[model samples]
Target chain A: MSLCLPYPTLMLVTDRHRSSMSLRDAVRAAVSAGVDLVQLREPDLDDAEIERIARDLIGTIGPRRLVLNGRPGLAARLGLGVHLRDGQRNADVAARGDDRLLGRSIHEAGAVVPDDPPDYVQAGNVFATRTHPDRPGRGLDWLARVVENSPVPVLAIGGIDASNVAGVLRSGCHGIGVIDAILAAADPTVATVTLRQALDRAVRDQQVADTGNHTGILGRGTMI
Target chain B: MTASPWAEDPACLRAALALYLVADPEQSVSGDLVADVAAALAGGVTCVQLRAKRLTDLDAYRLAIELAGLCRQYRVPLLVNDRLDVALAVGADGIHAGVTDLPIEVIQRLGNGRLLIGWSPESDGQISAAAADGAHYLGLGPIFGTATKVDAGEAIGLDGFADRVCHTTLPTVGIGGITSRTAASVVAAGADGVAVVGAILRSSDPRQAAWDLRAVVDAARGVRAG
Candidate 1:
């Protein structure tokens, strides 16, 4: 399937409980400040509730930017896309033949199969997040291995914030999927701008690093 | 707000590709390759590449590990020349391949487009093919001819280099015989930057040499901007 996945260098996954504002408002604000993709991840909501939220986000996010977590039919109905958990059924969804973006979440390396590949894979928790405190963060090495083995681009999710984003870029993931870094911030819009700026700087830094540019010494005056 | 330029996106394959330092152990004054690299970085060499033509596989692997550490400490990318295995072993940022090395397509597939691939293309046809093959950047020339790489093909000359640079959107670094005196002209001829081996390595103070070359490159880019 030739799916044109959204350019998700920085994605915001919604958790209304973690925010002071409504999901729609937070998403709208974040989108304005450079959050390129948003995944509606309210697992407690029913199909009707999801559809309602999806429609609202569709208005705000437009085409290909909103991904409905675990509800392919709802996504297809709204002309939106679906993000599947590993072991989730997609063949039935695939047969529906509505051209929408498809993504999957995988935690381990070599989990992506060539025969049934999603357009992009969301892999993480790259670092330990408060939401999943019991689960240890899979360090950058694991992330890099997963990126190398996967056929599709991988977006790192979980525990990624401004401080650690550069290391994540160096790990070779296509981009990052964030949670508290935006939702938990004092000002979600400002937080998103900060994260986006960090992401942009990290990207430029990675590019500079990849080009063999000296990294540790350039702007910090630590040369020598 | 207007849409962001494709070039501004970090995930896009564009690199600064400026002030490339082709690290040669034999040419280092201190007889210490890593030390020389540190000195060069201090002087503003933007990139560091380890080109160990005479080291054994184990030795190269050992040295790459050390050099990669130093590069990581400085946040510079460590690229291993012509040794994909060493690059993979050290977890280097990329590899610089000569024509005789593995093809760019093979490297891309093996690297899964994760590792940046730099190719040295001699002709316009080769440069075009390299870009189409998705090479991250092209290292073009023997721009003025030099003794660094005995087999560095014929010098492309300034005018010829300019003609070649116009052929591709991929960033190009003019290599071979680039010195502070000639570095400006190379940048003027439309190179994203100049890659030097002897100019920095053979200098009494590699840092000073790199600083001088960087001044020339920055000035040339300023001229291009104006």
Candidate 2:
């Protein structure tokens, strides 16, 4: 069976370290506000604990909407997508061929091409963030080169927020993967709405620009 | 192999090319290409192409990488001018090739048919060939003539633009000398969009410049639809 990945332009990567609420509540709120994709990235959690959170998130969000970070086997067992770190191997789990959406993280442009390409590439430290203060924001130029060369879609991750989201959209990425922008927000739902709106507006403007007809309601800027 | 997801969606492809912005850091009032581009995107420029002729390959590559991140955030497509390696190295959306650059067909193959190719064609035959060669879009003309690109050739004028647009089904964007004032004419002439350089890059406020141009394009499109 072919793997059909969800085309979510706004993705919320979870960070329990930053969230004011429980991971479940934050995920629930974010999903309610249009955070179509959620990546569970808790490195400290044991396999059992990770599975528990994954199950809970799946209960909150649908099964298809959740991805397990760095846990291909558990993800496959749960029938969810898996986001792999650079060196992690998915050879055993991926061979099962359950048609799961697979993503891999890349830091530089050259990393985009691998022997086993992923369904999508998540790249960054695109901007400076509290999560990884040691790594300077690779900036938009680096991300553009990656997007241009990658055979699959590229998702911008690391240090993304409402302020710089517009710039990221202009860089030609497939979408964004955020951690703090949603999880750390005082109101995760509102933050998710803001990011989703920015993404939707960018896409809507592009569509309006393409048709060269703005006479419709959108042209008036009355309807976002 | 499964067909790429974006390839099946025509609307996505068209949106990829709309409001194509060609940014030159040297020409920008702030002298910061990334900041200028971010501002432009904030004002609704849908696509960006970094055109840095004088910068070294290393310098250009560094800049492209940073801009790629910014463009990715907004979900816009970023193309590079005359630098296939840089585009590849940065994983940009694609490369925008001029007459002197690599042929569209060769670039497409090198990209393994993944990169979105935009070609600048001067005549009807070139336009047709480019479209047939699998160029995702065509950047046609110095519609009103300007000094932005030293070798932009002659102005195509509104009639010429209309003639060219009628000759090809590929999405076409009029480039060279277009500004908020004259952007409507290109849309009226049937071009899908407009590609600009100096008008926004050189303006005091790149953001406002982009916004004004977007407004003009939308208004013109509205008029055309009416």
Candidate 3:
């Protein structure tokens, strides 16, 4: 059997510019309501600005679950996980797997799974998302193939929110990794709970289907 | 494993899953492993998985190299069951990990990103986790129970099998004790296909055995499609 994830992972990618409140408060509230990991991704900010926000989040989100985008040196020294951008460096160097989580982003639709896959692959803007409004989102079918072919768990990102989370979960991904859904929501805590509930409810309903009458796959075989 | 780009395609994965042949060294009546797999491949087995529980690593690697060549000739994905090293060294198209083997998740995490990965999930709870963990397909069963795997637990009957099938959205193959008589029902039980060990390997004409089973499974899925 494959390694069972502790639960459906809910990661919040930090974008202070996108967040409605202070990044620290936003991360803390989301974590309290059920955000499993907080990725501090602010490339525009200088090293000092990024480090300042990361330290504040470390207290609320904890170093173990708080991931810094790039800056592998700081991540290693701070005892936290590291997330590498596309072509940043060899992922294996930063993907030290004991307790540190490693995440890689896939902006393209069908890039082959690299030789050294990360702990989790946060792939896609499955829909034309606000994050990259210009780059057309690589639809659900592409995401399905990635999920099926990937050896590591995939947390689909880009344009993800509660409204369409069930469909994302239906793609058989590990979970949803989001930014604006919680960060920019009117109530980040409530928004986080809503997404978490959608995931739990979808999983529970699927297992329940095992006991119910019909077990046919749904919608263009998306479930498969 | 040599990346079988076709195996990585979702559509191709579903097609390859349709008639999975689990070629166990212990179960093949003929001692020639390659011959048995070749015969099955010729008879329309879309996928071939080598299950060698007793062979030495070098022996397994050498045998896998031959089968990999044979499968390549047929343009079919060859999977080495529970032997990641052999699968990688020989450039087999994929690897299948059972409950006792190294977990697919750990294998994937440790840079096994090039091969198609199939998992044998043991419980209902693991069904979704298998999908989330990125297993290309699931090998679920002991569907009717058999002697090929002494430890393959009780056969989770058609009803029990369908119950588990409902728990996940991944493509799955019902394994164990499957034969021409029961392959259809196993498919009807919600499996994408059925995995057979002795049913084909033990037959004198492995080709015809695979042909007959393939016909049954295809017909069953055809009816579902209709």
Better of 1 and 3 by TM-score: 1
lDDT of each: 0.75, 0.76, 0.75
DockQ metric for all predictions: 0.02, 0.03, 0.01
* Cα TM-score of candidate 1: 0.50
CA shift at B146, candidate 1, in angstroms?
Answer: 1.2
Which candidate should be chosen as best, given TM-score against the real structure? 2
Each model's TM-score for chain A is 0.90, 0.89, 0.86
TM-score (chain B only), all candidates: 0.90, 0.93, 0.93
Q: Per-residue CA lDDT of candidate 1, range B1-226, in tens?
A: 1211111222222223557889877767678878778677656565578899889999899989988875554345568899999888878878889788999888877766667778887667888888687677788888888877888888889998899988888878899899999998998899878899989888888878877886678677652110
- lDDT tens digits, residues A35-81, model 1? 87788899999999998888888887786778888888777778777
For A54-141, candidate 3 gives per-residue lDDT tens digits of 7877776677778888887778777777788767653545436556667778654345366766777778766434565323334444
Q: Roughly what TM-score does model 2 have, to 2 decimal places?
A: 0.54
- In order of lDDT, best first, we have 2, 1, 3
- Taking the tens digit of each residue's C-alpha lDDT, what string does model 3 give over B1-226? 3455534566557656777888888888997778988778656576789888899998888888888876664446789898888987887877898777887777676535777889988878888798778688899888887989898899889998999989988888999899999999998889877888898999999888877886688678762110
**Consecutive 10-residue window with the lowest summed lDDT within model 3 chain A:** A215-224
What is the per-residue lDDT of model 2 for residues A90-150, given as tens digits with 9 covering 90 to 100?
A: 5745664656777788865767556667778888766545565333345566577778888
Candidate 1, residue B15: how far the Cα is off, in Å? 5.1
DockQ of 2: 0.03
What's the residue-level lDDT of B108 in candidate 3? 72
Give the higher-TM-score candidate: 2 or 3. Answer: 2
